[model samples]
Target: MSNKAAVLVAGSWGTALASVLADKDMEVALWTRNVVQQEEINTKHRNERFLPGVDLSPRLAATTDLEAAVRGAKAVVMVTPSSAAREVARALKPFWHEDMLVVHATKGFEIESMKRISTVIAEELGCDEGRIVVLSGPSHAEEVVNRCPTTVVVASQIAAQAELAQDLFMNPYFRVYTNRDMVGVELAGALKNIIALGAGMSDGLGYGDNAKAALLTRGLAEITRVGVEMGANPLTFAGLAGIGDLVVTATSRHSRNWRAGFMLGEGKPLETVLSQMGMVVEGIRTTKAAHAISEKYQVQMPIAAQLYHVLFEGLDPRTAVEALMGRDRKTEMEVMSLETWEQWHT
Candidate 1:
C-alpha cells in the first residue's frame, strides 16, 4: 500500500487532518478548488484563511486536481462540508479504487436524502457501504492544528477497516479508538450540533450554567432517543462520539454551531448569522434533516422541534424556550432505546 493519503476540500478540518497524516511522515495531498489556498499551502506552508497562524506540515501538498490528489494513495479522507460531500465524492468516483481505505470526517446528513456521510460516499463511489469508516468525536480543527492533546473515534461495521483508520491517523499528540457502531457514531456526531446551538443560545441569552447544563443533559437524551430508534447501540452515545462530542461542541469557542446559535440568541436573523459565520454550520442543516427524521421514525424530539422553529419557522428564541418549558409535565427518564428494556434486567 502507498504511504500517501488524500483529503478532499481543504477546509480547516481537512487541513488539520492533512497535517496529522503528514506528521506521521505520510505524504498527504489536500484537494481544493481555491487557487490561492492551494498555492498558499504549497508555497508558504500555510492555509491562512482556514487554519490561521498554524504552520502546515512540509510533507503535505495541496492541489486543485482531484485525480492527482488520490493517485497512489492508500487512504482518502473526505472532509468537505456535508453539502458538498456528494459532489466531491461523485468527482472522485472515476478515480476511486477498492483498495483505497475510504474514511469520512465530515459530519452531517445529506438533508434531501437524509443519508449518513458514509452512505453518501459509498453510493457515489459505487462501493460497499460497510467498508467506509466514520471519524468523529470532539476534536476541533483549531485545537487539533495546534497539536493539542486530542482523541477521536473511527467506526466501521468492519473491525479491520476501523483498525486500519486508527493506525493511519494516530500519533503522539492524537489518539484514536475504534468501534463497530458506525450508525451510533455517525448519528451522534451530527445530532450534537443542535444541542450545541441550544447551549450557545442559552449563554447568549444571559442564562447561567444551570440553564446550559439542563440543555446539554436533555439535549443528549433527545439525541440518544433518535439514535437508538435508527438502529444504533445505546452505549455508543455514552462514549467519545456521544456525550464527549456534545460537551465540547456545546461549550467551546471554536464551534461554528455554537457561534451561530449565540448570534441567533442575540437577535440576528438566520441569514445574517449564516453569512457572518463564514462557515457551514452543520447543525443548521442537520436540524432540518433531523426534523424530517423524527417525523419519519415517529419519534418525539421536542428540543429538536423547538430548534427547528427558531431556526426556520422564525419563532423567537425565547418563545421556543418557553414552549419547551411549558410542555405538559413529563417523566425525566423516558425509555431511550426502543429495544427491549428486559435486556437491562437480563
Candidate 2:
C-alpha cells in the first residue's frame, strides 16, 4: 500500500491530524470544501480561519476533490463535524475501497438517530460497523498543531484494525494506544462534551474550583452510568476517552464547547452564543442527543438534562445549577453494583 493518508475536511482537527501523518513521512491529503481555504493551505501552508499562525507541515497537501484525496490512500480519516458526517461519508462511498482503513475522529452523536459516527460511516459505506476505528482523547487541535505531547486512544471491535490505526498515527510527539472498547471510547468521547458544557457554565456563573470539581466528579458518574447501560465497558469511562477527555474539554481555553457554554452562562442566548463562537460546539448538539438517549435508555443524566434545558429550553444557568444541587440525594456508588466494584478493585 502507498504511504498516503487522506483527512477529510481541512478543519483544525483534520489539518492537525494530517500534519501528524505528514510527520510520519506519509503523503497527506487535506480536503476542504472551501476553495479559498484550500488555496491558502496549498500556497501558504496555513489555515488562517481555523488555526491561524500555525504553519502546517510541508508534506501535507490540500485538495478540493474528495476522490482525489481518497484515491490510492492507505487510510482515510473522517474529521468532519457530526452534523456533516453522513453527507461527507456519502460523498466518499463512491471512491472508498475495501483495502483502505477507515477511522473517524468525530465526537458527537447523530441528533436524529443518536447513532455514533462509526455507525453513520458504516451505513454510508455499506461496510461492517466493526471495521471502523474511533480515534479520541483529550486532544485539542491547536495544541496538537504545535506538536504538544498528546496521547490518544484508537478503538475498534476488530483489534487488528485498531492496531493498524495505532501504527498509522504513532510518533514521538503524538502517542497512540489501541483499545477494543469501541462503544465505550466513542460514547465517552461524545458524552463528555455535555459535561464540559456544564463545567464551563459553572465557571461562567462564578462558581469556584470546588463547584467545578463537583461537577466533573458527578458528570463522570452520569457518563459512566449511561455508558454502562449502552453496553460500554465501565472501565473505559475512567480511561483516556472518558475522564481524560472530560477534563481537557471542560477546562481548556481552546475548547469551543467550554467557550460556548461560558457565553451561555454569562447570559447570552443560545443563538447568540453559537453565532459568536464561529465553530460547531459539539456539546450543544450532543446534549440534545444525550437527553434523548437518557430518556430512551431509562438512565438518569441530571447534568446532561440540565445542560439540555439551558441550551434548548432557555432555562437560566444559575437556576439550572440550583436545580442540580437540589435534586434528591443518592448513594455515591448508586450506579456501580457490588460485583462491578469488586471487579474494578480486584
Candidate 3:
C-alpha cells in the first residue's frame, strides 16, 4: 500500500483537502480537467482561481491525467460537484483498485435521479455502497487552507474504512471523527445547503436575526424529518453534519449558495445570479432534487418547497417568506408523532 492519495478535482475544497494530506507528509495528487489550473498548482503552488493567496504544501502535486492520479493511490477523494460525480467516478473505474479507500465530499443530489452522491459513485464504480465514505461538516475551504481549526466527520458503513480515512486526513488543525451513519451524514450535509440559501435570502430581505434563527431551527426539524423517513438516524441531524454544517454555511460569507440566494433576494433573476456568482451553487440544484424527493417520500419540507418556488418558479423572495409565515398553524413537533419517537427510541 502506498501513502499516496488522489483528489479528483482542483476545486477549492479539493485543493484544501489535498493540502491537508500534504501537510501530513503524504504525497497528494490533485487532478483537474483544466490544464491551466494544473500548471498553476504545480508551478506556482497557488490555485488563484478557486483559492487565492494561500500557499499550498510543497508535497502537493497536480495532474490533468486521471490514470496518473489514481494508479496505486491508497485513498481517492472525489470532490467533484454533485452533478459531475457520476462522470468522475466512471472515469475512475478502470483505475480504481478494491483496496483503495473511496471517499466523497460532495453535498448535493443528482437532480435528474434524486440519488445521493454515494449511490451515484457506488453504481458507477460497481462497488458496494457501504465501501464509500462521506466527508462533511462545518469546515469552509477558505479557512481550511489557512490551517484554521476545523473539524469534519468521515462516515462509512464499514467502520475500519472510515477510520482509515480519519487517519489519512486528521491533523492538529484539522480534526476528523468517524461515524457509521453514512446515510444520515450525507443527507444532513446536502439538506443544510437548502437552509443556507433561505438564510441568505432572509438576510437579503432585511429580515433580522430572529428570522434567520427561525429558519435554522425549523430547517433542522424538516431536514431531520425527511432524513428519518429515508432511514437516517434522527440524532445525526444534531451532530456536525447537521446543525454544525447548517450554521456555518447559512451564515458564512464563503458560502456560494448563500451568496446566490442573497442575489436572488435582492431581486436578481436566477440567470443573473448564477452569471455573477461564477461558481456551482449546489443549493439551487439541490432544491430541485429535494422537491422531487419530498414528493417521492411524501415528506413535508415547507422551507424547501418555498425555496423551490423562489428559485425555479419565479416566486418573489418576499412573497415566499410571506407564504411561509402565512402557513396554517401547527405545533413545533408536527413532524414527530409519539409513534415516531417510540420507533426512534426503540
lDDT of each: 0.92, 0.92, 0.93
TM per model? 0.98, 0.97, 0.98
lDDT string, candidate 3, 99-198, tens digits: 9999999999999999999999999999999899999999899999999999999999999999999999999999999989999999999999999999
Ranked by TM-score from best down, the candidates are 3, 1, 2
Better of 1 and 3 by lDDT: 3
- The lDDT of model 3 is 0.93
lDDT of 2: 0.92
Clash pairs (backbone) in predicted model 1? none
Question: Per-residue lDDT tens digits of candidate 1, residues 133-196?
Answer: 9999989999999999999999999999999999999999999999999999999999999999
What are the runs in model 1 whose C-alpha is more than 4 Å off? Answer: 337-346
Please tell me which model should have the higher TM-score, number 1 or number 3.
3
Q: Deviation in angstroms for 192 in model 2?
A: 0.4
Candidate 2 error regions (>4 Å): 336-346
Lowest summed lDDT window (length 10), candidate 2: 336-345
Shift of residue 312 alpha carbon in model 2, Å: 0.9
